[model samples]
Target: MAGGITDTGEPYSPYVGLVYMFNLIVGTGALTMPRAFATAGWVVSLALICFLACMSYMTTTFVIEAMAAANAHIRWKRRESERVINDSDSMSDYSDDEVIIRDRVDRSETRPILSVQPGVSPDHFDIVERVEMGQMASIFFNKVGVNMFYICIIVYLYGDLAIYAAAVPISLMEVACGNHSCSAGSSIKYNDTDSCWGPVKRKDAYRVFLTIFTLLLGPFTFFNAQKTKYLQIMTSLMRWIAFTMMIILALIRIGKGHGEGKPPVAELSGVPNLFGVCVYSFMCQHSLPSLVTPISDKKRMNGLVLADYVLILGFYSLLSFTAIFCFDNSLLKDMYTLNFTDNCDVIGVAFLRYFLGLFPVFTISTNFPIIAVTLRNNWKTLFYREGGTYPWVVDRVVFPLITLVPPIIVAFCTHDLEVLVGITGAYAGTGIQYIIPACLVYLSRKRLQPVFGEDMPNKHRSPFHHTFWVIFILAWAGSCLMFVTANIILTETKH
Candidate 1:
């Protein structure tokens, strides 16, 4: 969730919320989009990206609606507790803490009151309280659904960590080992067997870099990791500068009529990769509560979210389109920033070239530990027992080790960013972004209807409030999973 907020408890304007959403959605996923676009063909990429953006926006609304429902439920519970206290004068003799404890024990033994009298209404869309996605799941979902939700999120976070773990090393390897003197007209591909230095192959160099990367950043998982405000400012500044430089440079080369790309009109084989990348790129649904909760003015929240989606769609289209046109598809790197390195024709300044190459190294390094710790915490939550505490060794040593080792091992085995991103986004990413939200919002509405009565109004209801929309989203997610799975199967068979 961009880590935790570093600002004072001040609410931001809607426009500021839009910017935050844009930044959140356009992280490492955007860096991998150009390669996906080049593979899938520009025309197919454009259409698919647009469709996915619409789907992502729809689910974003679902989350907001669910959040409002959660707030309404909390308000209802508090009101019920007040009524109970008022109805019994004898209860006044109990301490507040005693009454709260008694109420909690009673609540655990009782079925949730889902029925409110008709003609009663409450303001449900007030964003004063924050309800996280996990809490919402515990409130609205059945046991099976709650477990599924956590599993999906845990998987997505692991995918995030793996991508980050592989990316920085790949960037370092490219810059440290590859020649940076090549002209833009030249298309050179480095083989794994190619020597990086004395007796070191390029592939070996990548592993070494990965090892060093793990050594440098791995320990942060054992401790709480945070990005300070100054670090965030510097990261954002570098991000914008790097992105603008790439876009402008690509446009310049195109204007000079020196563009080398000849992308296809459509390519079915590349569609799966593009699907995964797009799903991964448009992932803000899970973190929407944190992003949407602190906005000062949420009167036009739907409009603001719509505007943000449009802006992000346009930004992604511009970035990828320029990239696919500027470079040949086969020559595009998994990390888009690497395209500027070693290409003097596109970027004349040597310093800027290296900066672009090393940008991910700086930005993603900040994010990796934060994500690792997040994943570790989620693991603890998943297996955590009620009222039972973990031993210090299990809590400290086991959780961090489990969180850190698997992704590192995966990164070590293969540094193929495309495959990693494709698998992660296609499966777990789809479940988290599409399927879970659909189920959560649908179940929330069903559970909330009895509590609020049919006449009670929810200000944050999704635009696509029909049952058909929920079914459509789940079916789409299921179909995408099946398609990606079958593609992997067929590809393996062919190999």
Candidate 2:
């Protein structure tokens, strides 16, 4: 169980693993961050983003350590099975419970004090297998806890898919509508009812683009998303290009002394949304097993992870600062790239303007299918039965349809990226990022203490290995949850 050899992907160097994590972290959430920061104010936004980044990194470490503990527990189970198989005279006669009781007593008594520190064997307990978060939940959590885990991740992935779904069409609609088309510069903000093509409204154009997006990328859900290897590379290149362009364009504007932005020192009213966006931006916890387990060498794994966090934090800061300072708070687009596309004063090159205008389409289109497939697989995992396979139709059709349709409907109803990202991140994002990892680490440590002994150490242990961190994370998640919920209620009441 410690051995993650079940995964078929080739092992890569830790540096490559770090890069993949970087790519994963700096995705859709980052695109919407400038607006969030602008609304939240630079001073408060900077402080909160920094705190969230550190908290996110801490939780990320907790997740890695939990994965190691999960693998260790599997190894223990296997060894226990082997012991029962070989020691038939002592184990065969009694019931399973009685056997466990006797086995624990006998093993504890015979084991040497120093050797009882943790492992049945240190080598055997390595985290070789890539146990996904869901798999780890099944292994360590009780029936209710496992069910809750699946529910949280499923909802988060659905929110992710919806954001990806809405973003592409919104980008396309902006480029298509006469009001926003990058063929010329316009500072005027248009309503959804504004004309796109003659009689068609911008909202209609959005729906049409959504349909095209669904048709173009939706079928990848029926197959393995890993087949998009080439596409992933292409989109990644485009991401760097877009980010660099945005940053450079912003810096150039700021340097010219034409910058219009003057964000307040602090704005408490905006903190709820800001918190959500920050939490969402830093979300890579769920996919850690895939990224971390593939590393060929992990001696400096923790350091590599820390460096990645620092770099990402700095990049996010640069991007947000340039954006908020380069454009006025009211003028900053929800998708920061749109600001360039919509303003000739900022970026006059027609080709670059079009690219910035439609960049979300390029990035989100490639990602939608992968996310859909992940959500589908999670659905399957939730309902999976022992020794039973899903029906052909259910596996191939039902799950994919369920995964694809909801998000499409969501995009149809609302193309507001800020609201979508904010609500999703504040709720489901909190679960996957903060609450779950803390619970996993706490439960995993407790689970291992009996078999491995209290003194046993997980080489993959996090810097925040103390019980207080776990409690603090839980408290943080609870507070964030309440804060967002209360904000929602108040906003709705005022409206």
Candidate 3:
């Protein structure tokens, strides 16, 4: 799911598409980016994030082009089947006016296919039907490849569920135990074993909240979430308000000469986590179909993508710069919202502080069920067999249990959001963000030559049409995986 929400598939304008993309790209991942930015230093963070934003945008276009190619593949399959059936009936050739422009064909395969007919544009590969990543994988990838795609995506979704599972309880624990006085500095923090209620430690309080949170939101995993429109609306509104309030308050504090932070220019030790956070933050490729397919006009889609990325980069820079400067670096919380909850000097009103504390609680709670259901559905799809159905208990109970249990258990083991987001994004996120798209687009282009000839131009072909871009993405993904693994090993050895 994109930013923990999927598109509704209703026809919408390009501008509307832009807003949805914006929402999809900015989620819990963005909330954690500031701390990573502060850790890695502003200078390194800014430069790397910009380069990543560009790379993410390029792969996003690759996904779009691959979607069109997937459509083409499906179309070719239907045509092949029709050709078989028609051969038995009469020698009638199937002809249509929807001809595509082709440059050249193989010497032996000079058939007017699509034979350069006039007055018809290249409408063969337009993304009308919504072929999701899984379906596209099936169409384009081998059996092993399909399973690999499912595995990568399923792992990423599990990571998402675990992050959310920990985030809400962590928020509740903070608000419940944090100091409420007019604290002058944002440096005040707490350890997990610190007392919250009498005899009840903060870690225990977190588990209590976690249990309550699971009981409340866990049921939605078994069924579809059709009635969350209003909840989503409220969540979206509150999310924007909370983010805006945090940014503004940080700016106000800095302006009042109370800014206590002085982040270093660069820190190489933090770069691995920063890479993961940024990769995670810009993760919308998996849900591109849900967002891009609904747009009524797609001619200007590349422009929309460019503009959206620009805006997001600016938003990330402003939010992170303000926070890193306004608060001491060591006191910054993994969940950035936790930083403002008890900072009475920054948010003087008690009620506002509580709201900020619980802001993630409300918004993330809405997203949890949605993501859990998505993961559950993916589980079903991965184990699914042709013409076979699961028994009632298995369908209703087993799938959901498998989906919900691992992440909750992982959360129980550790609530370190940085580590969770870092590991998830670096490995699985690399696969989803870079490797899969690169492979899909490359294979899709190769698949096209057999059916439509080599010179056929997909109207939605990416500007980076050379094989070099795809090779570059694959190489980068491989290098990233190795580097992150080595970094983790070295860090652990040191610890």
Candidate 4:
């Protein structure tokens, strides 16, 4: 809500809650969804979209409900503490208002508004006692053996860098979609000519560098756990405009005679695999806590949270299905726009190029702050201390280093969007974001004791509910495994 306590002893705003939902959908996922459909068929793409949408909805519901339970417990503990203090003469010397004022001033001076670290006193901590069944669903889609979700979360940490990293293909889309194809020699078959090889040439090196520069937005994570800021919101909105542009382009393509071919399938064809991939990526349900830091209605669940997931899947499905009808799998251009015109109008190309270029720039810029905050929070978790000047400094150094290292390797190693997406999806995108959370939730749930503590009976008390969660864990776990294997095969073949 408007004034909820966090681990860092600061209060957060309500709007940031929506940012989490929007950011997940509006970034790189939007850009490449068409490409995904080009490989998988239209019907498969539609199915994947439905699957992801359902998972996303259930996950968001789970997270919010669990958060509600946790906050309630924290409130109850504070009440108990207040009651004890009123009965006891131990702190009779200080007035209640004075103590509260002191705490408020101390927090305002010392903590970042977005910080989620709990206060030293358990009474001040907002504890999420029992994770809900819906929340458990969030973890289910993601917990695979090894996949892109891990890489996405580990590297991007819900920051601008992730967005930028995801947007890299958008920049290339303009060039790829142009009438001019980049064949090693004009006679090469599309599959025979590897996209990764182009960046090695001196001419394309600049483009690669530019894309990586966008990816470097990884350092911004430092501020994520701190507080709400206008700049962050505005930046996110700018990229969202790019998403709207893509949607417009899709509409335009449909209006034109573009969607008539063998339902332009994504050049890749692992439709069944989408169940796993989406389960891993969409398992982003656990991320809801990081969002809860900002809202005014701490107890009231935000309907928008689930709506964001629905909207994302809806967007993905639209693009994917459309692409399927537009081009054949092998003929499907990596960017999806190339199949449209040989004598394409200048205005259409210009619009596509301009927005495509801007999407990556904004995405990378936003990723930086998200990574900084995630690293800071993870560090606190490891060190067991409030993130202060020293911790912040450490995060500053580590965040950029981590961000810079991968892209540099990526730059020198390859520039093929397909290879990059495959590797990214297989490694970063799959693991941290989806698979790990799934495993953790499954393990954690199994580890829970049946009896709820005396302090809160409505919360974690019943062992009876564990049966449902156990089933969910198995369902998601099986799905994640399928996704991991499919990702490996698709990536290997595509590479």
Tens digits of per-residue lDDT for model 3, 131-238: 788888887899999889989999999999999999999999998888877845454878888899999999999999999988999888989875355775787788
RMSD in Å for all candidates: 4.7, 3.8, 5.0, 10.6
Name the regions of candidate 1 deviating beyond 4 angstroms.
Answer: 1-8, 90-121, 182-187
Cα misplacement distance, residue 301 of candidate 2 (Å): 1.9
lDDT of 2 by residue, 33-131 (tens): 999998988999999999999999999999999888888888777877877678887677789999899878977786632344333547534668888
lDDT of each: 0.86, 0.85, 0.87, 0.47
Estimate, for each residue in 334-392, the C-alpha lDDT of model 4 and write its tens digit: 43333332223212454554555545555454454545555445433333334545555
Q: What shift in Å separates residue 112 of candidate 2 from its native position after superposition? A: 7.8
lDDT for position 344 in model 1: 77
Q: Per-residue error at 414 for model 4, in Å? A: 3.6
Query: How well does candidate 4 score on lDDT at residue 265?
Result: 38
Candidate 1 lDDT by residue in tens digits, 283-370: 9888888788889888889888999899889999999999988887788899999888877778778899899999999999998988
Best by lDDT: 3
- Ranking under TM-score, best-scoring first? 3, 1, 2, 4
Model 2: residues >4 Å from true position, as ranges?
Answer: 1-5, 89-121, 178-186
Error of 4 at 18 (Å): 5.9
> How well does candidate 3 match the true structure in TM-score terms?
0.93
Model 4 misplacement above 4 A: 1-20, 76-237, 264-269, 272-286, 293-307, 327-352, 376-400, 416-466, 486-495
